[model samples]
Target: MARIRTIKPEYPVSEDLASVSLPAERTFVCLLTQADDEGRQRDNAAVLNGALWSLRPEHTALDTEDELRQLAETGLICRYTGCDGRQYLHVTKWHEHQKISHPTASRLPACPVHEPAGWCGKCKAKGKGCARPAPENFRSLPEALATPAEAISAQRPCTAATDLTPAVDVSAAEAAAPGKAAG
Candidate 1:
């Protein structure tokens, strides 16, 4: 379930997000930063409040809720009832903002336009190819993979597709065995 989230450096200016109050701006960013690849997440104010507390300690649950409400009103995010009957928040501009290579199917409701592009080379055929969420520790997807979630020694390099071993010289072997054909 570990993945990355990318926010272009020009997003704030390009999106005109500076006009909103600081808290609302932060909330919107948090929503994007914490959400899964499709920009959908449990629409629980308490959970969101907990996530934002470190950044804005003086803010309360009610404040976060208000900001989320504003985001919805402003067309930045939308709330929908999942098939499971639980409410979730889906960022309206997720696909517009992100460049997903070949996206997987989203768990959220249908969007105004097409969903993001994403493809998991390993799971695209059967359709389990949606983009995954980033880990809690990193800001986004790539950092998590590059730095790793656990100890360095605990990790293993993924080299299944390529070989990097040094090639050995066969001249010595041929010299040692004159009569034996080089099998």
Candidate 2:
């Protein structure tokens, strides 16, 4: 009978701690920083939503609609309820791209027919129109029509031609005569 040889498997043993190079450590740090930045952005958005909810609970649903859509597109906010209630705003499922940024640098200019042209109604009535347009331009139709003539006329030119013409300063009159304008 021939003699058979047996071979033993060898395993390596380590004694010193594994050393990670400075560059590798740096790479890890950079990854952590990016993760932290993303987290902070999410937190900021939550705070903004909370503030809006506090200010106008009724409009809370609409306040974050645009933001929510953006999140969905970017895979942030995965699912959201649409205004219709039947359709769901799914970021990943959307066929078309939706704009995630602010609609404009600022809110759209108020409708000239409804909003005051220059300043507050009190100022308009006193013939001292506001230095700036009213901040609250959104108002009901009844309210817009009910504004005081003095407030409306304050900013209006003395010429009768422009009297009936709709001007941007209409909000001033509406603010002054809430009963008539807001009715």
Best model number under TM-score: 1
Number of colliding residue pairs in model 2: 16
Cα lDDT of model 1 by residue, 1-183, tens digit: 434667878876845466567788878876776777666677778788898665667888878877877677677877654334455677887877877676666545432223334333223432242433322231112444534534553575544576865597567667698688665
46-121: candidate 2 lDDT, tens digit per residue: 3434543446555443335444433433442233211122122111211222332322221122112222242222
For candidate 1, the clash count comes to: 10
**Colliding pairs, model 1:** 3-141, 4-141, 5-141, 100-117, 102-118, 102-119, 103-117, 103-118, 104-129, 104-130
Model 1: lowest-lDDT 10 consecutive positions: 132-141
Q: 181 in model 1: Cα distance from truth in Å? A: 99
